[model samples]
Target: MHEITFSTVDKPKLLSQLTSLLAEIGLNIQEAHAFSTADGFSLDVFVVDGWREETEELKSVLERGILKYKEQYLSKRHVVSSVNEHYQVKIEPLSNCIAIPSDGTDVWEIDTTQLKTENKVGSGSFGDLYRGTYCSQEVAIKVLKPERVNAEMLREFSQEVYIMRKIRHKNVVQFIGACTRPPNLCIVTEFMSRGSVYDFLHKQRGVFKLPSLLKVGIDVSKGMNYLHQNNIIHRDLKTANLLMDENEVVKVADFGVARVQAQSGVMTAETGTYRWMAPEVIEHKPYDQKADVFSFGISLWELLTGELPYSYLTPLQAAVGVVQKGLRPTIPKNTHPRLAELLERCWQQDPTNRPDFSEILDILQHIKRK
Candidate 1:
């Protein structure tokens, strides 16, 4: 294996771009590492094979490839003259907030005056989730931090609203409304009182009995099946995105990375968390709705064991293992034979071999009935 390292300015999708460039050069990456420096730079290293050329030749080829990539992809013009100039240029056009395309249906533009925010319930890189009240009804509000607001963030927020507004299911989190006006930009949804399954399992030291486990599996499968039926894929299907209500009902939440599949039924570009990511996705291969099935399998394993998948390895190591060595979380010997079989089928290396959510739901329901 030849080790290659790159250092450049850090930006969104930088890792994905580097990985794609490596793949384009016919490199089979066995290991990968990425680090962000305090000075706003990224250092990425990859150990790869499949290049049978001399080291000097490989270096020349990679240098040329990077130049071509920059010419073809990177912007030539400076995006902003300065921070102040950038803020001034961005704020006015976005002041009215994202304009989601309409299908002549009712829009849920929330009145900020009626929204009452209490304590923060959760936080993420770009936003804070609050336990709030909207017009006397309990709601969870996700507010974007104004300082972090940018074009890409607004696009994601708009896409999420576009998807959420059209979906309504008991097994899926319900969308309430959105305050699309800038600086106060936020999305509101029904409050899930019990928090996330990750917290329930890891924080509270909880374990699901067989019956409850099957119920959770069924709930998630049903939700996924609904999404798949509608041509939507929940690229990130992990315990963290699965939330519970006061009555212990599990519903799939978080659609920030979720997307409606293209007409061709395949997508590229890496999205979602690493540990739960499918092998094809980690490899940046063309993938479809089946990618979500693979993630659901890893998530089902989490529900069964109450342990993080590949807890023994760092996330990048886990990703490399999954793609290079076909690694999966070990199923306990005491696990139900049928469920164990289902897990294996779901983790099949070939996407076609994986069971669809509809089939998975049937299998889980059968296990419960038996």
Candidate 2:
């Protein structure tokens, strides 16, 4: 086995990107370890087999792969500075970032002093999720990392708070309140003890038998229907964003990239995780609420198979195949016919050809009865 190591500035999805790079270079990783430095750099080491070549040749190939990876994933609309011979993407100064509108009301403003953080549960490039208490009630707090906070991050935070404050539904995570003030920005919601469906499936190796799968699908469909009725596009609809409470009722969570549908009823901006993104959105074409339906279809497949959408391909490669080759995950042969049909309708290339969430819910309910 050959050991490979990579060190770079820490960023969102960095580990996934690195793993993808190794896969592209024909490495079968046997073990991996990651560490983050106090100075915000990440060090990743991998033990792998599959390169039976000379050490110098392997080194050359890996260097080429790293260069290509940097160009494709790291240098998007940002200046690059070299550190220790590795390039780091630099965000434009805070002044260059657009200012967020201050038109929102402060009715849900929370007292930060009353907030008690217990432990960190998860983290992202710009924020960390914590399990905490508020007014003696268990809550989940998503706080922006102080060092990573910038104008662009703040704008997203403001947008999440703006949309979440108005939302209430049995299938949607309840918005408790938000600390919108600077340096302590956090959005609080009811704690989801059961965690995300993504973790349960991928991390815990949990399986959803047909009955349980349909129930989960119905719950997500109800939640998406509710959001659509409110003219809100979740934009990112995947297992990771679907959380479960103590009672095992799944609720939609995470609105950091969600937005109110524009008055014109179509949006052109491309934003979402590529693995589950709709083709129209991937191509940067104007899309409507039906885009969420496409993602929901992929999420449904994820639930059915307990696997990532494109396990063998990188996210960018999967996106390219989705838009150009009309690629989709294969449905298992034993899948219920009606449910399989519903999945096909949801994956239709034309947005208008897809079934709405209401129809999807009805179909899932029918399957549950059969």
Candidate 3:
């Protein structure tokens, strides 16, 4: 495998551009390594095959692309800085505040007074989620806990807020707005009355009819397909991240750890909870959107059986079993053969063998018709 490396400031869409450049050279990437320092400087590496007689030409193209990327980044920063001078948006000053891009993105800046926080609903690594009302509408407010407020965490929260603003899909949670005030940074989204799928399935001892299970599968696949099409990777895809509405329609939620696809068609660092994490991810190997598909397989199994995968084992045990022994959750004997087959494909040891979300959607649609 041929290896390539570079470093740049971490930003959205940077990976898409790098991967697009590699593909333009007709290289089939086999592995990727990416990491960032505390100051947002990213180091990326890629391993590839399928080299033709155009190696020299490929080098020239990559060198030119890197220069172009730096130029564009500088230009965009200059423009945003200039626009912020004239814009009257009330932004609270904080040492940990993320630089919100002001290039006409539709991220609504909600006044802090408009949101009314009620009871706490859940908690995440960085924030406490609450049931709240915004502009007379029920919403979920994720407030970054004061103790966790830091440059890195704030940057991640900002990234999630920015990404949520750009996505609009029935299968994806709707972003309402955000309160950028210091000591109370919050992200607000349309609340799903039914809460998360994990609670519906395991916590409440819920069972799903085959038809309903198929529908849930389709909904998640559709959302993921849209994300992939936009070159985004929902690094953490699990039942807990899937919310249900009053009608039980599933919508993808929680993006604090999600990221835009990197230049190597994969990211190097480990992410997502271990139970739903792919083997590649667990091992800190290179992984791309296919990693999400692996998580979906475990989620689909959970939907079908209403049981946690490897319930008897610790998360670390399950992760070890998956990575070291290629173990997968056992399918219920009564499960449909087709469904079992689909799950196997999704959790394939070789990520390249796993089908994309679009194909997964088609298969679910076919199952729904049966």
Candidate topping lDDT = 1
Better of 1 and 2 by lDDT: 1
Encode model 3's per-residue lDDT on 1-370: one tens digit a residue: 4556656665544444556666776767654444554455555556666775455555666677656655865344311100111112224346644566666846588877788999999985457999989988999998987754656567777889878888899999999988776776889999999999999888888898899999999999999999988888998899999999998889999988788787767676545777888887766466788999999999999999898888888565576688889989889899888898999999999999999999999988987888
Candidate 1 worst ten-residue window by lDDT: 77-86
* lDDT of model number 1: 0.83
lDDT of 1 by residue, 1-370 (tens): 5767676765655666777888899987765645454345555656677888677688878887787777776445111111121122243346565788779778699988899999999997569999999999999999988866777578889989999998999999999999888878899999999999999999999999899999999999988899899988888899999999999899999998788887888876446778888887776567889999899899889989999999998676688789889999999999999999999999888999999999999999999999
Kindly list the per-residue Cα lDDT of model 2 for residues 297-347, writing each as its tens digit.
Answer: 999999999999999986767876888899999999998899889899998
**Residue pairs that clash (backbone atoms under 3 angstroms), model 3:** none
TM-score between model 3 and native: 0.75
Q: Please report how far candidate 3 places residue 4 from its true position, in Å.
A: 32
Span of ten consecutive residues with least summed lDDT in model 3: 78-87
Task: Score every model by TM-score.
Answer: 0.78, 0.75, 0.75
Query: Could you give the candidate ranking by TM-score, starting with the highest?
Result: 1, 2, 3
